[model samples]
Target chain A: MTSLYAFVAGPLAWAAFLFFFGGLCYRLLSMLRQVRQSEPFIFSYMSLRYSLRSILHWLIPFFAMGWRRNPILTGVTFIFHISLIAAPVFIVSHVVLWDEAWNLSWWTLPDAVVDVMTLVVVAACLFFALRRVLRPEVRFVSDASDYLLLVLTAAPFVTGFLAYHQWPAGPWMTIAHMVSGELLLALIPFTRLRHMLSGWLTRAYIGSEFGAVRHARDW
Target chain B: MNERHKEPSEIMDDGVEAALSRLTPEKIQAVINSVLKGETGARFKAYMDTCIHCGLCSEACQFFLSRDRDPHYSPVGKVKQTVWPMVKNKGRVDTDFIRRAVRIAHTECNLCKRCVAFCPFGIDIAYLMTVVRRIIHKLGATPLYLQDTAHSHASTMNQMWVKEDEWIDTLQWQEDEARAEIPSLRIPLDKEGAEIMYSVIAPEPKFQAQLIYQAAAIMHVAGVDWTMPSDIGWDNSDMAMFTGDYEIMGRIKRTHFEAATRLRVKKIVMGECGHAFRSVYDTGNRWLGWAQPPVPIVHAIAFYYDLLKTGKLRIARKYSHPVTLHDPCNVVRGGGLHEKARYVVHQLCDNLIEMHPNREHNYCCGAGGGVINCGPPYKNARVAGNRVKAEQLFDAKSRGAHTLIAPCHNCHSGLHDIVHHHGIDLEIKFFSDIIYECMEKPDGSE
Candidate 1:
């Protein structure tokens, strides 16, 4: 078990990070090249003012028209995303691990807060899963991969929650948590999760188009 | 999946029906594959990837809102029904699928970009719908009436099939009619070096020639130097854009721009039409590889706004009726003329009752994007789809707005249908119509 943990925590973790960053760079560069070749005018209309305006409005909960219309989804989306990012970065254990590995550390969240965040993420994932399975509009667009992506997103948090609490299969859960988290990071650049990066580019393109050319607010 | 199995309305679109009859699987595969592989690039990829399909865009769609929030009419739902499958299957779909896709892309969506404002990622479902339209157009499967309109544009450089002499005759007739009131008023034709080349949709000459008279009178009273083209490029409207015939769209826009360029006019001021403005300023220009219009294009709202703002055209008396404004999606949202439109309205009208979601966020009149051009067969669905717009009109009427000023031609026609169909008692008018009525005419013309 220790050897398996070492394998995942050592080379597997490095491979995951390398894949994540490298794949994102590759995708970004390729998209830029494609756009430059096809629609170079996108660059001309890209305005910093409008891009920031659009991105800032969308980041705020209920500030955007779409977010305001679906309050429940907005609440769930914000919570899930915040917790998904926050718990991983600020958890005491993760910080301690960073400190031990590279002598790197930032301000860590209280254990109780991260625990709550993890639970929120897990719950939000379930909410998303149920929405996909139940809502016809969501269901119509969702395939098995959507549900699988949700499970993948939720798995690390769920197993981490169980492992942190020292539940029935705590050690195994930790291993499962590490593996799932690594897998998710590796898969993100290839899947819809790449939206995390491309969404900003799209928002910028649209914002510039709406602002500079159309002279309208995209948000 | 708890998908509602409602009895789908049988819309007998002979264009789609006949196209489907001629289509073979190999042809479908080839056409879809070529468009997907050749035409689309990064914009397509980014949109397809970034959309998480959370269904947030559903509420932004009037089709969804009007239909009790049915998922099928949702912007993402439309994509799921049409383009997503095409992408997934690599264009291996059957004939029936193409028919349904034509209906969804052509009849269902207004391509208003309202959904873009609502999407968290700003995924352009309108762009995706246009892709489906592009594919359908390539396959020669566009709806019959809309195809006929495209054919007209291809053959005549106009959508209404107006001959050159007929166009000149219509202008002369309108000029003669306007002269009865303002004896000095003349609708100048083919006047080179004119400061402004005034262009209009072919419908103005065909069915709404009186609008041309009103425009002429407004121009005369305002003392603006403008001339109308009595040539092949006189009609500024391009139904081809909606039909996904970008070749014809490019040609039509080129002819319109070249007419203004040939006149050596400083600018082209188009009459009240949204899609035509979009064609000239945004889509048609881009397709023709121009980042900006070759000649400066001014929509009617902007022209009136300028005239009113600059005190060139003074209103003798503000219109004394309670009026509501319907912001056309292309101009208000697509052109950012919302504030200007409101300025023109407030200058002309005494009481301006605003719709619940006014300006950029207003509901589409359900007729833009060539849905209205699909003609009578789809009229019921077109009207049925925009029940929310009817409710808005009703709300405005209940608030004591007796007249509704829709600034775009398509919105004028679409709202006309809605008010008549829904028994909403609000009268419709263009900004030009109201301005022609309320502006100071030199000869006291009514």
Candidate 2:
């Protein structure tokens, strides 16, 4: 039990965090360097104004153009993201673990709040999976990995919830939760999950190019 | 029967068929490899990596919608069908794949940029398709008619193959007709240092000389100092830009700009042609390494908006019939002239009906992006695939839009087909059409 805990909590945790953040930095920097090399003069006079405004506009889910066209998907996406961040970053248990692990801690959400968020995360994952299954357009583009990514995303939260309540297979579920959480983090830079990091830059470039150069309100 | 009403499977014209026959597996692989390896840069890589395959962009595409949501017509699907395999296999794709890729890039997508607006990642799918076009252009697999049009641009400095003497003659002919309305009106030729040089697409001379007369009438009535060049650079339209013939695109743009610079004109005010405006202001200029046009260029929509705003052009009487404006994708969506266009429309027309999705969100007219230049073979599928646009026009008609006003020449041609093929009893007009009828001619000139 001690060996298992040490490997999961120490070495594996270090490897996952390093890969997640290091790979993310590399991806971002490489993309920026390549864009600079291309020398695409983003044709706009008030480019920064549009870029910042668009970033803010899309950051709020309701204010986004996509929200109007796709309310259900937007709502589910918002819930999934908020819960995904909140449970990992703000939950009391996670904060205590973080404090003990690295002398790092912050204000934490109540257990009840964390519980509801986990449930929302789980539900959102299901909704995404169902969309892939049902929508013809979605089905056409999706493959096995898309569905697997959904299950992988949901695994940690599901396991964590079961571990919290001391459900059957409690000890095994705790280890499973830790391993799946680390795996999800490590996979962020390698999968479609990178959109979480790159979405703001994409939205900004689009808004700036269209709004400043074209002088049309794209967002 | 008009080509727009023909069945889709029967519509790949002889030009496209001929181009397809020229393709070989080795040529296809080599061209694709060279393009992917050398031409594509960070933006392409970023877009390829960032697309999540959510299929949200499908909803924004008129082709996809009109095709009953066929995934093949979706923007991402277009990329998947054309470029994905090339990238995955490192350009070892077979000739059949290359043939399908050419059709998908040239005929299927209009490069409207609506999908860019809707994309969660804001991916410029149009730019990706343009890269495909560049590759196909290199392989000599470009459609025969469009390639010929580009060749005409290369050889004659015009897409219609109009002779230098014939171009000047058309201007003289149109000038003679304009004199009946205002005898003092002159289609000034080779007048250097004019404030404006008016340019038009070649089809104006070949098919619609009357539009030249309308423009001449407006210039004379408004009393603006403008000239029409008699030289080879007069045609501002570049089908080569759409065909990915960058060399010819550069030549056409450089010629147009040099003509304006030679005359020392303040700006070039182009006639009602959207894709030509795009060529001068965006793609062609950028290709020539000019971030901006060497001499400023203005689309007719913006030009009309300015004239009305400055009271240089006054309304004698607004057109009384209810009319709807079909926003040309290049002028409205690509150029950001939607509000100015609306301002002109409201000033000259008594009753204006808005299309369902107007302005930047407007669906393409299925004519621009060189699709119409693909000629008769592709026209049927072109119109059929844009059934969403037809429906939008029909809805506008249902609301009592007696005339559908498309300000750009390509939009004028494309929307007219939609109206004709769909059997919608609506007249198609340009902004000039409404303005010519409604603007006050100076009393002495009249």
Root-mean-square deviation of every model:
2.6, 2.0
Docking class of 2: medium
Clashing pairs in 1: none
Q: How does each model score on lDDT?
A: 0.91, 0.85
Q: Highest DockQ: which candidate?
A: 1
Tell me the lDDT of model 2 at A39.
43
Residue B156 local lDDT, model 2: 98
lDDT of 1 by residue, A1-219 (tens): 889999999999999999899989999999999989987878877899989888888899998778888899999999999999999999999999999999999999999999999999999999999999888888888888888889989989988998888786547889988999999999999999999899999998888788888888877
Stretch of 10 with least lDDT, candidate 2 chain B: B4-13
Residue-level lDDT of model 1, residues B21-95, one tens digit each, is 898999999999999889999999999988888998988899999988888999999999999889999999999
Cα lDDT tens digits for candidate 2, A1-219 = 879988998899899999899989988988777766664564233267888877777667866565668888988887888899988899888899889978998999999989999999999989888998898888888888888888889999999999898896547778888999999999988887887777767778888877766666564
